[model samples]
Structure formats: C-alpha cells, structure tokens
Target: MTTAPAPPTLPRTTGAPVPVVPSRGAGPTRLRALDGLRLLAALMVAAYHYGGRDGEIGDAWGSSPAYQFPTASGFFAYGCLGVQIFFVISGFVICMSGWGRPLRAFFASRVSRLFPAYWAAVILVTVVFALPWVAYEAVSPTDALTNLTMLQMPLGVDRVLGVCWTLWAEMRFYALFALCVVLPGATRGRVALFCAGWTLAAVVAEAADNSVLDIVLMPEYAPFFIGGIGFYLIHRYGSRDTAGWAIVVVSWLLGQHYAVSRLWHPADLPDAFSYRPSLGIVAVITLGYLMIAAIALGKLRWANWRWLTVAGALTYPFYLIHEHLGWVAVHLLHQDLGLPAAATFPLVLVAMLALAWCLYRFVERPLTPRLKRAIMR
Candidate 1:
C-alpha cells in the first residue's frame, strides 16, 4: 500500500537531461526502475517476515525459523530494513505524482489506488485465518471495519494485517503533505518549506516522550520520506540545487542515526539474529538512499523493462496478504502436508505471488476506475 499515487509511469523520454524542471501541471518522465525497486523492497520485507523471524509463530511451524533454516536466517535478518526503503521510495513517487496536480487529483489517485486492493486483502486474509483448519483467532468485526479505514493504528485498534503499520505511516505522510503542501500550490518554494518544517518538527518530535507526537510526526520515519522528496526535487530542479542536495544529506544523516538507534536496542523478537546490527543497518539504508539518488540523477534509466509495471502492481497486494496468510500457508504445507521448509517457503511465496497477481488483475484493476470516477465526480 506504500506504492506511489500515480498510474504505471510512462517510459522515460530519451534525451540529454533537461536542466529546467517543468513546474506547472507537468510530471517528470516515468522511471520504470522505481517500479522494480519497489518490488525489491517488498521482497526484502517478505524475506524478513518469512526467513528472519522466530518464536512468535504460535506453533505455526514445527521448528523455529532459525532452526528451520539456520544458514539463510542470518542473511534474511537484514531484510527488515526494507520498510525504510519503501518510505524513501514513497517520498520520491508521491512528490513526483503530486507535483502540479490539484488536490482532487491527488486525493482520487491515492484513494482509488490504495483502497481497492487493501479491502480485498483484508477480506481474503481475515477469511483465511477464520477457516476451520487454521488455528489463528480472528479479530472482532469492529476491528475489521476499522482496519478498512486504514486508521486502525491511531485509534488504538489492532491491524488486520500486521504489516500495515507502515501504511499508517504512509497515510500520515500523505495527509500532511496534501494538507500542508499540495493543497496550497506545490511550488518549488512551498515544497522546500514543507520539507524544512517537517524536518524541524520531526527533530522536536524525536526529543520528546509524547506518544501522540511520536505517532503523528513519525520522527523515526520522517527523514526517509523527506529525503525522498529532496531526491524528487533534485530530479525536477537539476543537479545545481544546493538545497536539494542538503535535504538529501541531512535526511540521510538523520535516517542513519534513527535506524541505528532503533535496530541496536531491539529485543522481544526472539531469535531475530545478531547480524552486526549497527554496521549492516547503515550499509542497507545507505543502499536505499543511493538507489533513489541514482534514479533522480538519471543514472539508472536503462531499467525500463516492460515487466516492472506488473511487478509494481503486485507489490501492494503481496505486502498486504504476505504476513499472516503466509505463516498459515507455511504451517499447512510444512507441518500438515509434510513438506520441507526449503520447499514450503518458496511454495508459499509463489502462492502469495499468484494470489497477488489475481487480485491485481481481477480485483484492483476493475475497482480502481469505478472508485476514481465515483470520487472524481
């Protein structure tokens, strides 16, 4: 659900870099590579969930994840950094799509794009868990309804899908950006100011112990999104924009600090691996930032393959259904069907991918246009 608020982006027009970014109602050239990168980020998160985790399975596995796949668990542990990657990409894509559009267009795109697939996934996962063969307890109807609104986090309701905390973060970012920046005009001057103000507020939000501020400001995640917007600015404005470079650098520094702090003192996730958290965290997040910067600078424009748009379309649905449903599938296959972890993992992943494609093709594709027209009207 953290995918951008735009349609499948158009192919990049071949030419030398245009020094001047079109400011009024003109979007930047479609970076097909961003689509592929988003799929990579989603897969990274999937790896962390499938391969990195342990002990929280509630007997979902015969053996713990670490014991089930000892060698691979070490590597997959670092995949938790994928959420940070998604936010950075979200920042860039949201900025690109939001530029020069009216508030209505922005609203329609986000609502239409996110809700259809999310609703489908919520129903699918909820029903799967409630099956007679599945051992998991289903959430109450009240919570299920709230989850549909995608505001379950702030309201203190549990998420139907565990991964949606990131969506809550994405929603807050969009809400603030729409109200504070896009609603007004989205000029270069205005966007820069929005970044500046958000950054400052985030810093303050970090220093305080206020839970409300933490949730609202998301000091932990603001930098990645801010950095993404900065990268978009660089893409739009050109290489000479000192302020754009500064935003990316500062956001990167803050992101490194926040990431290191969060990942270092982590406890409670049993057998989660001791993979040199500090060094590995820095390297992984640095990779995300560098990828965005490379795209903005047009260094990776050659990734315009036709298949990436399909990959990007599957990201949201795959992410939505992957967590609990995947756990159940693995348990069903490995424990009940007597499949090995090696086969079960790949099988479940493939099954989820197939389901994602089905939902994207049949569910989201059909619902998006009607949703857009209803809202746009």
Candidate 2:
C-alpha cells in the first residue's frame, strides 16, 4: 500500500498578506506557526535518532521485554513521521516560491540557503570524529571533495557527516522543482497536478519494486510532498468541505494500524501482510490534506502561532547536528542519570535546541549567504 502524503501548511491566498520571496519561499510564508510545526517535526526525528542510533529503542523495541509494546518503545518508531511532515511543508513552500522566479535566481537562493551550513557541519564532523580515527580510516581528499560538492550520492560516496543524505535528497527536489518551473505549461495545474502525478508514480513504483526514481528525478517520498501540495491546492481552491476530512481521518487510522506497518514490512510477514488497496493510506493522505487546508485557507495570521514556529526556524540546524552527537550523549547519560527514557527525553530535546541555535547564530547564519554569493559569482 502507498504511504499517505503529508499535509500542507503553506498558505493559499484569500487576499491575505504573505511574504513573497524567491523560489521555495512560496505559498503563504508569513505563517511562522508552521515553523513551529517544522521544529516539532525535526525534534521528533531527533528523538527517534537518539534512541535508535544508540541501539536503545531499536534493541529494546525489537526484543526487550520491558519495551515490547509500540508506545513504550521510546520516541515512537512512528515519530519518524516528522520527516514526511517536513517534506510536505518543503514541497508546498518551494513550489509556491519557485514558481515565479527565474531559474538562475531560484537556484542561487536555494544554494545560498542550503550549502554553507552543510559545509560547516561537514568540517565539524571531520574534526570531531574523523581526525580522532585517522589511523582507523581517514577521509581521502577525493571523498572529501565528493562530499563538499554534494555529488557523493551519485558517486556512491558516503560522507563523514552521515546526515548529509537528506541534504542530497533536498537538493534533488530543488532540481526537480526547477524543471516544473521551466516547463511552459507546468504552472497551470499547481497542487492538484503534483498530487495526482505523484500518486500515479508511487503506485507504479510499488509495482516495480523500484526505489531509484524516488532518489533521483522522482520525489523520493512522494506521499509527503504530494500531501503538502494537495493541501495547498485545497486551501486555495477547494471548499471547506468535510468530505476530504473524512477520507483523511479514515486513511490516518488505517495507515497507523495496518498500512505503515505492512508497507514498510512484508517479506518478514506472511501473504496476509502483502499489498492491498489500503484505505488507511488514503486516510493518512486525506488527513494531511486537511492540515494543509487548515493552514492555507484559514488565514495568514494562523501561521504565526508561537513556540512551534520558533522551533521551525531552528529545525534545519537541529536536524543537521543532533543525530550523531545527541545519540551518543543520550546513551552515555541514560544509565548514569538512572532516568527512564521518557524523563530523559526532554533534556535531550533542550540540548538539541541549544546546539541548533548556537549553530545558526554562529556558524550557519553568518556563512550561508556569503557562501552563496561567492559560489554564484
């Protein structure tokens, strides 16, 4: 079964004010509350990583008697759902902003926003992790150059920074979005087109057992991006109808209970767990649709909600640095602190917040724009 796409939180205009930046800043951007959503999503991802990477939750969830239950497994294996939310939000915003900009301008802005911080993180990872283990296996100059250029994935190269995979994916998405902008008739359909086309592709992908499209030209995770696009379109043009909501809710329930589990795993399970036209997947997609609708149609003011937005603003850095370091920190502290994962989760969260903020204020913010200028020149 296909996974449900994420809900759109990007704005759809009803004569409301919104920030009009270049590509990827599209839809309604003044909705900083979505920033909060972004932050929340990133944090959830961080939590999942912290537990899983340290072999705490995965080991526990998979076998430990105390952590047998899904809920008790630690940050909810489902908490990784946050990544989908981020994708949905990114698609909506990027499509909206990039739609009107020239290709040169669009690419420049994206490169500017994305790369500097990434390079800095790479440098940090090398110094902290790579240098210490030089004799064990050092990063060759060629590998370093591959990573620096963000062509590591195509070359089948791994980075000193493990989290760089997502950046590679995001960069690919940007390239795809650029194609949409350049196509003569591409602007006409907007979200509906993206959602329908992605759904069809996803169905085909499932049949082919081909995951390559997603990593390349295709949206690696169509459900999330399509979900975001679907929500954005509905907010702009669809009615305040409850029909879509019904589909979304049902899909959400079904997906949680059956689809996500089965979709992610089938070989381990019997024929009973094999592919079926899951209403649960549809429900999940529909739910995302409703969320996007709520944000886009509701009002620009709606996006300005507090803490989540603050978190959203910090999400990128948090995501970039948190996993490896935070995972190590949480585990080393877990036994010593004698705290349950639940009790200790918030401390990890706070530490991530602090570190992310410091990275932004000190490393990313200062260097990103300057790097872009230098590169584009």
Best by TM-score: 1
Determine the backbone clash count of candidate 2: 21
Model 1 CA lDDT for position 267:
48
Question: What's the alpha carbon RMSD for model 2?
Answer: 7.8
What does candidate 1's lDDT look like per residue over 74-111, in tens digits?
77778888899888888877877777778887888788
Local distance difference test, each candidate: 0.79, 0.54
TM-scores, each model vs. reference: 0.90, 0.71
